[model samples]
Target chain A: MTNRWGLPHLGYGVGLRTVHYAEILSRWPAVDFFEAITENFLDTGGRPLHILDRVAERYPVVLHGVSLSIGSTDPLDLDYLAKVNRLARRVKARWVTDHLCWTGVAGKNVHDLLPLPYTEGVLAHVARRLRTVMDFLERPVFLENPSTYLQFTQSTMTEPEFLSELCERAGTGLLLDVNNVYVSAVNHGFDPVSYIDALPRGRVVQYHLAGHTDKGTHVLDTHSTRPRDEVWDLYAHAVERLGEAATLYEWDEDIPDFATVHAEALKARGLAAGIHREEVAVA
Target chain B: MPEPLTLDLVERWMQTVLVHPESAEAGIQSSPARALIDPGRVSEVVLASGHLTVAERLGIYQEMYLLRMRDALESDYPNLARHLGPHRFWHFVSDYVEAHPSRSYTLNRLGDHVPAFAATWGKRKERGLISDLSRLELALTRVFDAPEDPPVSPEALARLTPEASTELRLSPVAAFALERVRSASLRLLDSPEREVVPREAVPGSRHVHVLFVRKGGQVSRRTLEGAEGHLLEALTSGIPLGRALTRLGRRHRTTRPCEVESWFREWVEEGVFSAASLDPDP
Candidate 1:
């Protein structure tokens, strides 16, 4: 289960949310790894960092950021990158990752993972910025596909093609969020299986499975409930193609309990095992 | 047709529409969106699916913009949001973000200007109290995020002789002193649920200064008054023990020297000072 860069497969885990903070510290659940939101830890030196220090001591914690804004038109924020790199070093994070969307423009941060037009120009622009970020951090970063509500008429390439080319050009890794693939496919009229099949399998280092809001016409990446049956089917498809990767379940809003989330994450194990058994039978 | 839309132009136009205060269609016709791309040409740039049109698709982003902003502000200022209620809080969030959109990489800093902005809520009858509550919460936030410096031990203070104590220079941890606040407003924070308490029309009318310190990863507050307040402020501000005491005595005639010594002992025990050094002779 080695990625192109030989990053380790950390197995199934859940997002380290704040609601389960106290429970995690006291009980210390039996999870393989924890994915922390990077922006939540960068500015504060107090309780958040304090708790993170303790968590990093016991578990493998990876930093996933929202405000990296790698696809943004604004100049790269070197100071922000420096802090991110420092935090990575402090926690000894496995790898850093962010979405493949622009957050905001003209120096203001709207804080939403806004979509990018899939064009040749966009691919080159984002690749250039991503190279700078990876070089500055001295590590390869994973970029996740965003669930989009609309498509730009200016886009000449499909979402998967654009992401594949961008990863190749930038020398980065793919997070391969299957739920995002399902959401985007449903919203924009594309085959989710085709989206999974097109990605560079070796470049995929991680997987994100989350529930979304079905708004009849479009789907929102709310991360508010359990992963849908369609999303789980896509995750199985991803495992068959990509072999093995670190899978994480995310439930940000209306989070029931840590145990419940952990149980949901454990479901990935059965899918991964099924893929492994098929590979053995073929061998 | 006009020249083909570049990636930059598309992004600019989309951002303009997304951040506009009005609906997505109205946003397209607005000056900012029009400056980048014409409203009539929006359909040319975006593809439409079944029931959803181009403008409606773009509207999804416009609607989400405020929800994200309010979520960030509400997390940082829960009590203040409760005080204003959801409706007024949403209005405040809109105006506040428009006035001071996030400039930092982290949403943690999104509400940095909330306290000062709250002071200008003059139209509300409880504006002063709101301002006071905002300031207190802001302090807690700042203290929570501020750098961690180990506080000096009580043994360090005990080792100093009378002569050394007079010339002792001290450094306080981050958030050493917050503004002077009323006893009533300060007590409001003591409630199990601050929102349930009745809003005060006028807060900080009974002036009592507060001290903020980072203790074991928690931000703790203490009330100080008269000489006690002045003395702590002076020490945290880098005044030598003798000079700070002298200034306090001059300003507060009722402050006794014995009381000052006991206050110094209490501050030292509470881990107020991070470092202490003998002041150089003049």
Candidate 2:
């Protein structure tokens, strides 16, 4: 009974940001949909929402939140969730997603998507919490693998195995971060493609592609550069397995321009198109 | 390795990564092409070694992120930025971010606590002028970003007889509030060019009234006093046109009517309101 995403394919998308706001509106770019940061439009009856309203009229919008902090031991932030949920309905968003990590505890926000150890009890904890949240949202939550710098010595499960289990238990979807795969594989020393193959095809409902920083040993998910060739290969591998979900090209810091980000997104679309054509050829 | 106690190990790992990055070791082998390090031993162990330590590079993120955020606050609130000057403003921001790294995901909501932060920090005399400047700056954006409302327009006003004038309802965009504070605060804000007046006590000055509104999707801020501001506040907040006028007249009977008339007309031109909320006859 689990559907993947807004089907008939949303093609490829880019994180619609303020820098490219003028460009997208002025030209009505060729993107199938724009992924908006839900927090940006929430409580914004202002110009941000003004432009968002116009964009929503033309294209599908997906609401992504950073502060939902659903994993926190703290009681689900009901007020924050309600606000974002209302805005999601406002823009008719496709799906909502947040990281598979805790943001804070004891009512203080630590900001970073800190890692959670892969273990049986922790899986139970996450599954129970996500079930509560998904029930409240009344929709499938797409939990993403974070670009992690560290791991727990106590972890008994491979990251992929743990993720696979969570999807089964919570009945949620996965927004696989290919760049995070490359980043984590390199940072933790593993085969990125192997990690991709381990994911349950049914769970991966979306895909995120972005660039990261390699300042030597650790790779930072800065999303400030073009997606590296290695990450692109991993993305291709993911498409072969996960098929085409809602693929997004994310360029946050040092964002070049609308044209550049759009073109990058086009590359993902081209890849997806290739996948579709290949699927048709086989069919 | 012993299986980490489920929740206990997860919390420990999170605490380790949340505070620092170089913790944990995992099963993956280091591929120069792939790039992730040993996730097992990194617990309290950063991978950056040779050229720059993890501390050094991560320091760059910590510094730049903090500066980038502080720069946003400074740019948005010029008067406050000027008051704090360059070094002192950053000093406070650096300290503040370290004390309270943002919990929220969006950069848009990062500075909501800034005004309150300023009140506490400025009162401590760390970087004075933070509270008012933060408030004024926030007011500007709040006014600009506030939802638009329909108001009683000129045509509606024209139909009102002198008898109806007693209930002169304010337009939605006609919002103004008087915030009195010690010293000559707002005079420094307005000018063809405000000469940088050094921070010092302004002797004998009392409170100053403030104005706030969004015009054409941008915040418009200024100063207003007494009856006019009260008259406008009343009308926009749902008082009828007749009652608002009576309130204004009672408060400012001493002032000449013509001056108040010109002020009201100027606000109308600023895209303040569409028309009053409630009306009759028309």
Candidate 3:
């Protein structure tokens, strides 16, 4: 928490959306900071920027971009990355993050986070690219574990091993997505608790809590509803491992009112408190 | 040596799978190695633990591939969406996404292809939804993001004579646009409560005109008069001050300057231009 960048040691937060902009700014709710979708404010020169400007006055802003496609082979889309860097600097983001999965390549964005084969070679590629991204931004970035649907036969590393190596090698931090771990583990058939155990505990700087759809055979990271009980259990484990850091309750789809999302944020705050108290006991 | 594919390479192929159904089957085997039914185990990784039936799980990757993008576009281009109706709209969004997934990191950039893609659909043309409604929404998006250029000040105006006003330079933000049509149906998109609005009716009027705007953080529209639409077209195409005035001579030519003066004042206050170019060629 001492070395935490733009958004350091911030308790619990929520993703900023237009629907909740007024509530965040006017009500000045009892929250730490707000995590904004980087894409919403990027390239927008008018009111959205003005809104971000207002929101920034009240709280810290962290950048989360889905299109970074950091895992894509598309040569780092430097232009877009540069824009992200500029925007992050403008708002003084604590730390920006994108998915460990690829968004798109070959000049198209499929708008979904597809998992990569966890192999030594892939890890090396990510390490190299992540270093370049951090260098470009002039600040360390956090890579989140994507809630993925498919797995490759060629993968050699487990999700935890890959993420730990990613942070340890690239000199980056981890944005442990508790919901993604829960969703992916359930969908793929593994132990969620074990996945948490394997996480890069020390390097984790933040956590994202969100709701997902239970599609029977597989779970989808829909981010449209309230966090489920099972996700809460996983989050408690995340807090226990990573301690108190910046956490976001991501409700991107069917986003409820500010109060609804805030209610969820309070749930995360309560969990985070328990985890912090436990850490003190352990220490 | 069977070198492994990078995340970048997989992301590239994943891009293909969204549009090229062929990639869906290419990446992984058809049948899952094991059957998965439990939803409670949300954090476990079955594949990492050696479950190979990962392909079926990845199918969500395919379904969401279309669903997420379709949702993005429908929010902005409801008129075009309504024009296509649910079935045809889904077809267009699906087909367009397959060919052109969003490349920008922003959701604002997702519908960039709808306008161009509409050129290919016959239903889009017949319905007049693609070009017209698409143009309206896209312009609204641009206006929403356009730099905040306060309209020209009253002093900047009071200082100018009729002759000077004619040659004055203008910023691109004071944009004016129209589709080559005769119907007013496009206005349906401007309504505040968009979800319940009826989408289509028999075509009437040979052409239509409307104004697109972004104010106070929300995008809206206004119907433009014939003269105003003409004036806006003149401005958007980089026409100089006098030339634009001349183009609008049919309505109220620069000869009088009074009528044109009022119009320019209104446009300036609308946050249309960042500033008028002092040296715009006459």
Candidate 4:
């Protein structure tokens, strides 16, 4: 399931975090690709960006942003967009991605990925904005389904439906976060497998596997530890369906050594291997 | 027909609820959120899950807002947080965000106003010291994110002829900042082992000039006084070298012109200048 741009699958990777900088530079681990939080690197011209330049020189890198606020009603932040675009080009990111959520409006940033209502009106608004963003960026934008805790009654469709429809209308790509799918499904009392199946096949260009704190009743996507067993199970299912795409493991809080996070990211290889075996069986 | 829940209204309601300094209930009832959707109809706007009501779910976002802001600010001002202790630091952060919520996309800029805000943070005994520390940390943060321009080479400094001093233009290194801070706060922050202690335990609120520079990929500070600080400020202010030296000479009759040349050599060796050009245009 190649994307419209035919971006290659860079295989299993881990987010390039600051905690792991010294180890990454010293050991130069054999991770396939490194996903950087674009906003963290954008405004800094210091050590973090310095490390990113060195890391980009060695391996494939992709830019995942949080502050794009794609669904917000306020006028688009052209300065932020220009910075993101310039950074993607500066780092030679394979493709740029942000969340399918709004961060804030009214010229103020809440800095959290707030949920969006899934309706025809909102869909058309977001799709038009996404197209404008992609045109300015001069590349197809990829959006990930964020882990949402609340749903709007005004929402007319499920998140998966909204995502598929938006991707189709906007002519963008998808970075399906399996963990978020599971988190949102569990919170919303929907079937995660069904949600995955509903996604547009060729539109998904990447995958994010991360840990979440399941607070018995509601799940929080904290990205603080290794992905749970259920999340890994979901990743296996995702690889089976999505076939080939770049996969990244995220551990933003209480992050351990590079070896620890890298080891967790390496677990995706088993899932990718399972896909190959299933392909052989189908043949 | 009642106005449909347009994207604008939905965003306004959610942002209002999420950014309220108090509970989400207060946010939903605020005039802005209420204007978008009736306070009684919050459930109709934001659907509730089995375990949590709409307000409680909104509480989740409301709760995380300050925590995220604190985390970013803590990264920028760890020494300040350490000095203030955990509980006081959290209080300070809560008050700080309310006064100046993030207007920029990057969290790096969220603490841009902390130094000034700390200065006005309640009339406390340690207010001046805390403000000084915060100002120092803010300078470090700015220097860290400042544009990365390589320092002028020693060879460039060596090539400067005394006759060319009148036309010489020196541009401060991109990752360089000047701060006037209390000597006591400077010592405490510079110490490797930092801890919260009584305000009186540290001495010297007397003013001191400090030069912050990013060299070898680390932000470091140097103490400066008198002509050193003045000459550097002059160079940074676009005053040519000869005129700057003349000003320093006029101000300090006891200071030798030889000292100014030494300071220039020292600044160049310290990688304080990004570019040095002879300015006929200026």
Candidate 5:
């Protein structure tokens, strides 16, 4: 299903990283789009920004941030929001996204995506903050479901329930990370398929697929290697349900060459195509 | 009864535990985490999932936090990390973050105080060398991310009349840095092949000046001679070319016009100066 905001299905893309900058610019690979980490280019006028500008000129670019801290109790960093808005305007980004988590508290940033309790009070708080963020950016913002290792005992609602209500109340969109759903499911012992089935389909404008590390006791969303077979299976399920969403394959750690990463991203396209064909046949 | 776990309390408690310099177990038992919630009730606060205990789950975040900080600092200070070796560098990262935890949204700013922090660390004799290396690496990191102003071309300077040239004020590009560091630190930076530089190997004396500038999206460094460093410093500080040359002539008895011209040509070619404007009143 197409999102309510009319953001395009940007096809298959990779996270634009420094190690692959030269090859990306010179080869100009046939990837559909590139997701630039917002914080990396926000404070720099150096080669990273220069490379992003050139890539945006040739391919679609989206801004994905790690430090938005949207769920933090601290006052929203207006300066950070303003820079993000300016960057979005500069690159004409297709959409901007951050995780549905807090980074720090009491004026200190741990720089990790800390999970939030899915309680009524927390939901109301995050929804209100998200509204302000969306208004400031002058566009709909997407919040991805992070891979969390622990669950709060006080959480009165499930993550999907909280996200569904958040989307309805805040008028925001969802950047569903299938790998996160899988990792969180394994870590928390929940049905991953049920987690995918619970989200508002029209609000899921993008999908993230990545590899993870299994630590025997728990799975870490390392994004270091190729997406495992289980993650691919989950992606196939999501595409069948969500219907042609923009898909991005992320490989942040031990990242392989551009061709290898792109090949991994293309797997989504293949699976998505097969799903699309089956849906057409049924219709 | 303990205070109810509100969102605020939970966030604070978790952060206190995650960023604690010690283990998550100790963090839970620490005064900070205990103040928010009873340490014994950690299992009640965080659920035990699957095969993982409450402490082990919290330990995941605690372990990853220091690793993240170490990776970021290592990226910013490769030479410093290498000089310290993996074992000592890990300890240094642990100590550094405790003293100056990240308060910024970006990790790029996390190492801003590394040089100052390094000065207070290690043996007194080796402190200067370590601080100098940190300062050098920090300058390179800053120059790499500084604003990219269009550099002034040599042809632009040549087009100006000789009279206007003397009165021209040169501005250094935003992506340029002039650092004064010890010669020992320079040797450490230059020798990338060496995995580790023993503390005793670095001589604590002999200082040198270095220039870091970004050109065509790449950062390059050049060590400066004493007179050339003074002249560039003066020009960048807003002194007109004629006055800066005169000051250089006084400071260095052997300053020559031909040598100054050669330095000017090289600096311009290196894209150090972003713009050259006539000093209106000069």
Candidate 6:
């Protein structure tokens, strides 16, 4: 099913990283879209922004931010939100996204996506803030589930439940990271499939797949390499459940050549195609 | 029987733990964390799941915090990191973050204080060199990301008569920065291979002035000669060309019309001046 806002399913894409800038500008690779980190281009009038303009002109570009701090208790950074809005308009971005997490508090940024408690009070708080963000951008904001290493004991509900209710209250969309679901599942002992199943159907507008390091005891969402087999399996399940959504393959750390990273992202097309075939057979 | 934590309290506690310089155990026992939640009640606040205990899970964040800060700083101050080497650089980053944790949304500004921090750090003798290196590197970074302004074209400069040029006020492009450092720091940066070594202040080390400017999306450095640095500095400070040249003549005895012409031609060619407007009153 298409998202409620009718956001397009822009097929498979990869992050617009600095290492691949020359290749992208010269070759204009066949990736469907490029997700530019909002903060990277927001504060610079440099080569990164220049390349993003060229890439956005050729392909669909979306803004994936890490510093929205949507869940932080501090007053919303209006300056930051204004910059994000300006950037979105500058690039003609299809959508803007940040994590359903906080980065810091007391006027300091830790630069890490800190998970939030899934209590009723927190849900209402985040939903209220999400609405303010959506209104400021004048578009539906998609919040990705962060790959959390720990859970708050005060959480009264599962993460998916909290997210589902949050979308209902805030009119927001979801950028479901299948790998995050798997990582959080193992880290917090929840069912990954059930986590996907719990998300409201029409709210999921995008998918994020990435490689994570398995430390035997727990997992770190390093995004250093290719997705593991289990993550691909989860992506297939999500495709079958949520229908086609814009999928992005993230490889931030030790990223390979453009062909290699694009090839990893292309793997999603095949998995998603297979899921569609099964749906056709059932119909 | 402790009071239930609110979202505000939880964030404060976690941020305190994550940014604490010591171990996660110490972070939990930190005064800031203790002010919100009892140190003994960490497990009660943060759940232990799978094979990892509460402290270990919390440690994941603590470890990643330093790693993230290191990555950000290393990207901005690559030469500084290389000079300090892995061990010393890691410790420097740890102390640096503890002293000045990130307060901005973007990591681009995180290293704004690196040069200042470096000036007072390390051995007293080597501090100046390291600080100068950091200042040079930071200037390059700033120039790379500075606002893009079309450089003044040669045609524009040619359009002005010699008399008109004397009253012209030249504005440097936003993507330009001037750095003055010791000659030894520039030599170290120019060296092919960089490694951590004991650096002592050289006797009678001369100061070097360099200009960093971006042209066509690439940053380039130029070492200033004669009194060009003073003239450029004066012009960029809003002095008209005539006045700046007069000031340069007083500042440097070697200033000559021939040398000034050559410097002006090179500066215009190098895209140093973004715009040149005649001084309205003059």
Alpha carbon lDDT at B185, candidate 6: 79
How much DockQ does model 1 earn?
A: 0.74
Q: State the C-alpha lDDT per candidate.
A: 0.84, 0.68, 0.70, 0.85, 0.89, 0.87
Q: What is each model's TM-score for chain A?
A: 0.98, 0.95, 0.95, 0.97, 0.98, 0.98
User: Considering every candidate listed, which one attains the maximal lDDT?
Assistant: 5
Tell me how each candidate scores on DockQ against the true complex.
0.74, 0.26, 0.43, 0.78, 0.81, 0.83
Docking class of 1: medium
lDDT tens string, model 6, B158-230?
9999898789998899999888788677755642221222233333367767788888876777777548877
| Ranking according to lDDT, highest score first | 5, 6, 4, 1, 3, 2
> Model 1, A1-283: lDDT tens per residue?
5667777899998898878989999999999999999989998787788889989999999999998898888898999999999999999999999999998888888888999888888899999999999999999998999989999887899988998899889888888888999998988989999888988777788899999998887989899999999999989988888668899999998999999999988999888888889999999
Alpha-carbon runs more than 4 Å astray in model 6: B1-3, B190-204, B280-282
Top-DockQ candidate index: 6
Q: Report the lDDT tens digits of candidate 4 across residue range B143-208.
A: 877878889998877787878867788898888988777888786575332222222223466777
Among residues 3 or more apart in sequence or in different chains, the pairs in candidate 4 whose N, CA or C atoms overlap within 3 Å are none
Model 5 per-residue lDDT tens digits across residues B1-282 = 767888888889999999887899999999988889898888768999879888899999999999999999998899899999998899899999999999999999999999999999877888888899999888888888998898999889889998888889999999998887787798767534222222233344566677888888777777776898888888988999889888888899898889988998999988999888895653
Instruction: Chain B TM-score per candidate, please.
Output: 0.87, 0.65, 0.73, 0.88, 0.90, 0.91
Candidate 2 chain B, poorest ten consecutive residues by summed lDDT: B21-30
TM-score leader? 6
The clash numbers for all candidates, in the given order, read 0, 41, 29, 0, 0, 0
How would you encode candidate 2's per-residue C-alpha lDDT over A1-283 as one tens digit per residue? 2355443356689898988877988999888788887777776676788899999999998877777665666678877878877887888887888889877665556555666767687789889988987778777777889887656555789899989999989877788999999988877778999999999886777789999998675688889999999988899889988766778889988889898988988998888788779989999
Clashing residue pairs in candidate 6 (N, C-alpha, C atoms within 3 angstroms): none
For candidate 4 chain A, the 10 contiguous residues with the lowest summed lDDT are A1-10
The residue ranges of model 4 lying beyond 4 angstroms of the native Cα positions read B1-3, B190-203
Flag regions of model 1 displaced more than 4 Å: B1-4, B122-125, B175-177, B187-204, B279-282
Clashing pairs in 1: none
Residue A261, candidate 5: alpha-carbon lDDT: 91
Looking at model 4 chain B, which ten-residue stretch has the lowest summed lDDT? Answer: B193-202
Native-to-model Cα distance after best TM-score fit, residue B128 in candidate 3, in Å: 4.2
